[model samples]
Target: MGEKPGQYLLWNELRGDWCNYDIVGEQYHGVAIYGLLPDDWSREGFETQRMFELVPEPANPHDRWAISVRADGKTVGYIPRQDCQSWANVVRRVAASGLIAMVPGRIYARDAKNWDEWDGENDPPREFASTVQIKLGDPDGALPINNPPTVPYTMIPRSAIVQVTKEDEHTDALLKFVPGSGYGTLFVTLHESVSGRAASAKPVVEVRINDERIGQLTPQMSQRFLPMIRHLASRGLVTACWGDIKGSAVAAEVRIDGIKANEADEVVLDGEPVTLPALIDKQDDPETYALPGWIDMAVQTGARHSYESQPESTTSSTPAAPPLPPAAWYDDPQNHRMFRYWDGLRWTEHVAPKVR
Candidate 1:
C-alpha cells in the first residue's frame, strides 16, 4: 500500500522478548527533531508559549535546519549537524502537506544561547538560541490494519478529550511539561509480555508519566470501557481519560460521539486535508456515434448528474453540487481485506468494522 513519506517511525507496538525489534531509527524522539543537549543546559525551556518556524538557506536548504523561536525572536543553531538535513526534510514534508497542524516538540537547555555548541566554536554568536527536539506522531499511523486491525490492548480514548472538556488536574498532569495551550488524551497501554515479564503486551493497561508507573485500570473501569474501547478502537477513534480516583486506582471517563462529521468538511489523511472527487459525474460529451461501446460506458458511469431534468428547465445555480457524499465504508484502496471509510468524501476512522 502507498503511504505518505514524512512520517518518521518513533516506535512500534511490538512487546516482550519474543518480539524482534530489527529496526533501528534515529536516536531522536518521534520524528526528525532531537533532544535537549547536555552542554546546552544553561536555561530552562518554556511550554508551548513561543511558536517555531523553519529557516533554510536556498543554497543548503536540506543541509541546514535553522529553527527560529518566536518571542524575542531567536534563531537557534541548526539541529545537530548529522540530523540537520533529516529534520529539515520533515519540516518540508509537513509544510508541503499544506495542513495547519501542530507537531510535538521539546526544547533542551543550552550552555550558552550564543555559542554554536554543535559547531564546536567556544566563541558562540551573541544571538539567542535553544536546542529543539521534534517528535513524529504514531509511527504506525499508516500501517494497514491486520484483517480486522486488531489492537492488542485498547487504544487511547479520543472522546475523553471532550467528555471532560475543561482542562483539569488530570489533563494538566500529563502535559505539564509541554508548552502552549494544549491538551493530552489519556490512553491505556498493556504491561505484560510472552516471557511473562513487565512489558507492553496485552490485557492490563498501564498509566504513567516520565516512565513512572503511577496506576492501572481498575476492574470496575475496565468492565465499563472494555466493549466501547474495543468498538472505538476498531473504528480508529478510541479515546479515554485516566486518573487517580481513590488509593491509586485508575478511574476513566470516555465520550464516544465527539466526532463531528461536519467539524472538518474535508478529509485529512496523514495530517493533510484532502478534497473528494465527485461521486457521479454531472457532465460529459454526448456518446460518439463512431464507437458503439461509448453508449454503455456513459450509462455505467452511474448517476451522471444531480436534480433529474424535467421536460422544462429551470435556472438555478447548478444544483449546488450534491451535498458531498456522506462518509461511508468503501473498499480500502490501500489494503484489500481492510476496508476504509470514505467519510462522505475523504478517508477516515477505520477499525475492525465488519466489512460487507
Candidate 2:
C-alpha cells in the first residue's frame, strides 16, 4: 500500500474541551470538542461515532486557514491552527469544488465517580471532562501500492468525454518505431505553461505513452479534472490512468472511457488491464447519480477563488503556542504489558493492564 499521510491529533484547550478521556481501551487521533454532557457524562457516549464536516473559514481575521469541525450544523471546535496549515489545501480544494468533506467523530469522556478501584492514586477532577476525537488522514491512502497513492475523486454522474487533439506527429513517430500493432498503452500527465497563453488558461492533462506525449484532453475535460489534479499535486503524487492509444498516423485517438479516479489504482499499480463498468446515466439512476442541490447552487452562484490575493495585515499579533496533547492511555515506551497514562504534561505512574 502507499505510504499513508499519517494521522494527526488536534488538541487545543482554548477552542475545545479538555482531553480527559476515561477509557484505557479506546484510542483516537483527533480534536477534543466541548459539547453536551450528561450529569454522569463519563460512563455514557463513549465510542459512538457521529459524522462531522470540516468547513474552511478563509475569512477568519486571525487565521486564513481556520477549519471548523461541525456536526448537524452545530460548530464543535476548530482544527488547531498549526494542524490547519497542513490540511488547508485539501479542505480548500474540496470546498472550492463544491463538495463537503465529512469524517467520523467520537466523544471520549471520564466519570471519576465510577472508578471501581477507589485507591484514587491519580484522581481526576470531580467535574466531568468530555473530548471529541475525529481522526484525520488522506482520503485515498489505501491504494496503488506506490510511494504516494493515486489521485482521489468524488463521483459525478458520468465521466467527462475528452477528445485527444494534436496527435498526428506523435502517432507517426510511434507507428514508425512499433510498426505492426498501430496501438499503444497510454497514461495521463498534467502540464502547466504560461508561455503564449492567456493568463487564465488552466493546466492541461496530456495523454502519453512511455514519456512520449501522444495528445491532450480537451479544455473542458481538463477543467473537470483540475480539482483532483491539484489535490494530488500538493501531495507529490500524480493523477494516473491506464488508457489506450489507438488508430494510426492518419487518425490517432486516446481513450480512457468511463474509468473513475478511484479505480485507477489497480491499473497504475499492477499494470492490469482496466475494465471499467458501464456509465450510469442521470436519467436512469437519478437517486444515485444526480448532482446535489448544493453543487447546482454553487455553479450558479460561483465560489471565491481557493487562494486569496490580498496582502497580509500589517497588524502584528503573537502566534499562539501549540497546546499540549490531551492526556490519555498510551502504549508503554518501556514495553510493559500494561499501558501508561500520559497526564498531558508527562508520563505518570498511573498504568492500566491491557484489555480487549
The per-prediction CA RMSD against the true structure, in angstroms, equals: 23.5, 21.7
Candidate 2 local lDDT, 1-356, one digit each (tens)? 11111112221111112222222111121112323333443454443444455656655666766666654433455677667766664454444433445554566555335365456777733433345666554322211111111333111111333566666657654454232345533334443322225867656666555445666766666555555556555655554543444565566566543223332232222222212111111122112232222321110111111112222221122112222333443445443344454555776775444322
TM-scores for all candidates? 0.24, 0.30
Whole-model alpha-carbon lDDT for candidate 1: 0.28
* Cα error of candidate 2 at position 251, Å: 28
Model 1 Cα shift for residue 116 (angstroms): 17
Looking at model 2, the pairs that clash are none
lDDT tens per residue, model 1, 1-356: 11211211111222111212111122212111212233343444432211233323323443324322111112222334554443343333333332111222445432234343346745543332234444333322211111111232222211222232212335444333221212222232323112124584335333433333334444433344445434444545423222211111223332221222112212221222212111111112211112111111110011111113211221221111112333433334444344354544566675322122
Candidate 2: stretches off by over 4 Å: 1-45, 112-126, 139-356
Q: After superposing candidate 1, which stretches have Cα over 4 Å from the reference?
A: 1-51, 54-77, 100-224, 230-356
